[model samples]
Target chain A: MKSILTEQQLEITIKRLAHQVLENHVDLTNTVLIGLQPRGVFLSDQLVDEIKKETSTEKIQYGKLDITFYRDDIRKELHIANRTDIPFSIEGKNVVLIDDVLYTGRTIRAALDALLDFGRPEKVELCVLIDRRFSRQLPIHPDYTGKSIDAIVSQKVKVFWKNRDGKDEVCLVND
Target chain B: MSLSTRHLLGIKDLTVDDISLILETAEQFKEVLQRPVKKVPSLRDVTIVNLFYENSTRTRFSFELAEKRLSADTINFAVSGSSAAKGETLLDTVRNILSMKVDMVVMRHSASGAPHFLAQHIPAAIINAGDGVNEHPTQGLLDAFSMRKKLGKLEGLKVAIIGDIMHSRVAMSNIYLLNKMGAKVTVCGPPTLIPKYIRESFGVEVNYNLKETLEWCDVANVLRIQLERQNQVLFSSLREYNIAYGVKRKLLDNLNKEIVVMHPGPINRGVELDSDVADSKQSIILQQVENGVAVRMAVLYLLSGRNPGNN
Candidate 1:
């Protein structure tokens, strides 16, 4: 396993992404944050916390979306459902869809499908902690990328959260 | 992954993994119910026919709605209006339906094992909606799903199923399913309502006393006494049943533990359970209704195979 981002590197990358988001949306008035289920949700929680610490933004609309049903590979295998506590509506909101890593862009595509079921958002942007280059099956691209990596076809990128995994790091391992 | 059988005939036929698979798939679709646009284009090319020989409007409608949400074209067979009313056999009616290229048949018949018979004869997938005191597999699944959701796990959880044990498909299916999921089950009611072989055949304990049964269980799925199904005197009177078997506040408090109250509804409120207990915090009766759609969707989604048109 090749370590990509250490604890300090992860912190710096997250802070940079948070600053970039704040710079783009000053008030975040119509902007709501949604994270893909399970793994992506950790990044969302950290991002929201970092954003709140840096800025005086209160009442930030944050939700966790489960894209299990919308996934293309659902029929191919079994997928356990995750928590989907998106209470507020994303209708007419500038939605920021967050995930830990962008690999084949299939998960983002599924998230997009799941999001459209909620409501027609004004605009939807993708944000990721790591973006794998030239490995996308779809034309989707992340608007806010933290650390872009060029991993081989047979390699897998695994993101480990500090709270859940007892460390904050990213690894690229050969399959 | 596909189920071992093409048709879901009964809970007796499902393994614990099969039960878990259906519940997990149902949970995935539960999010769809919360969405504003409650339609998914998953089964656009497939067609399902709801063939009900008996009047189960509630269960039938739930399956129909689930099919619609999955974008599957549905043909709600009016069994009474069709040639089946003119004394057509179940086999002939379904054969005619299958000739129309129907991909799946969700059947609710008055006779036991009607879906099983159709399943053997027909090529299309068969889901036993309700088969005359035999099994309502989806209802059993939804109840177990709700149980797992509330109690966190199914294994080693004690569940007490009370009232109308003799004629309830719900009771039989729940007993088979909860047992398969490694939960202890007790069927309690009048001596006449409790079948003798249920204890010996299934190994689920039989209880005649309500208070003792409530004390023993972590969950009590109080079932509606089907008056329509009752042709003989099973009990002395409704008041006696209420007094002896009905789940109310006093009996619930005797348990002194968090016991979930559940019902397969169209409830005989005062007969099987009181209003206070039915509407209480311990009850997950309403959540069962919401889960019915999701469970049915999962059953449909998994059994129908991947939609070739989805890609």
Candidate 2:
């Protein structure tokens, strides 16, 4: 059978991560999970679904962050960024930021700067599905990680979801 | 042999072979127009849509006449009084119109890649009438087509695009197409209006003085002064701009007399070019407008996948 993560393994991993979050974080009232654009939104939703299934309630809220304009490289040119529509309010919430793959942590830095425009959060904790911690430029670390892989910068690791391609698997492509 | 695919989004998308094929086909269409009846049976049953977001009466009329002369039905959709003002996105409007089963779409928009974006999604063949400052492939083709006729061959011809380099889509398109056609191109304008890295990127010379550029060129293609461009802080004043960059009678006399002058209309009569020069023996401005219809007709028929007369 050709599989990256078996259906049984993915279900077990979600439950484990939910229990880990519950053990560390006590306040669930004002807690929110915000996802980075594209794949991060999908991972955040999966985490939220697992938390709801375990607790039997929708106590947490979700939002999306688009950091296209906030990046340092876009300073020289015109700053007309792509769509950044956050439907839910994030004022004074305990936020858990989620992403699919974390490489240089520059995207997170850009997202953090963009988030300050909306409102300051009580706290911001980073969560990533696959953390290839080889190229770390900033003093940033993921609090909760699904898996960590040792790899060089010349390769790219892709996390496949069933919603995207009917499966959950990670593959490294030559960059 | 027929040209392979449809959709003319950029000159970058055209292969060298495809460029030659279009020029050759346009030559045939030009011949057909010179007859007693200035009409062809090339695209009889096809319907062409002139969907222009920008206000260009000259370009719009040219495309309309091009389709009509080719025996194709044409619908002119000007942006001012259209459903676009009712808060509909361009793609949504195009898709709704495409459902009517139009054969080809000739689009002119202020946004650079808007026509290319439409080409990717829409089922109908696309002809980029004009995009922002990015490209105007048909204008490039017609300019090159007209230049080739005068010079006999594009190889070793020195062509300079004078005035408004920054805001001129005509200049950008000509630089790429003329270079591809093997003519050495030079862009001359003020440093503020000219992009910083144009010379390094296109391998073309950039000069601030028109006299220096014209001395080395066989053809000088002058661009119009867009007053709205001044509002965008591209330049400061019109009077200063015309005195510095405008090509007048005195300037024309300074150039090589064999140097042909051309402008894409509607020209600013006294701003970028002198009215006498535009109306002179050296000017191919009127010839360019006349050739525009035939060139566009060839493009429509070629992209439509219909035989020139078999349709």
Q: Pick the candidate with the highest lDDT.
A: 1
Q: What share of the true interface contacts does each candidate keep?
A: 0.47, 0.00
Error of 1 at A125 (Å): 1.3
TM-score of 2: 0.62
Q: Which stretches of candidate 1 lie over 4 Å from their true place?
A: A1-11, A57-59, A72-79, A134-137, A149-175, B1-5, B149-156, B227-232, B236-260, B273-284, B307-311
Worst 10 residues of 2 chain A by lDDT: A74-83
Q: After superposition, how far is residue A90 of candidate 2 from its true place, in Å?
A: 82
DockQ for each model: 0.36, 0.00
Which model scores highest in DockQ? 1
Q: What share of the true interface contacts does candidate 1 keep?
A: 0.47
State the lDDT at B62 in candidate 1: 93
Residues B238-277, model 1: lDDT tens digits: 9989999999988887667879999989889899999999
Candidate 2 lDDT for residue A65: 66
* Model 2 docking tier (incorrect/acceptable/medium/high): incorrect
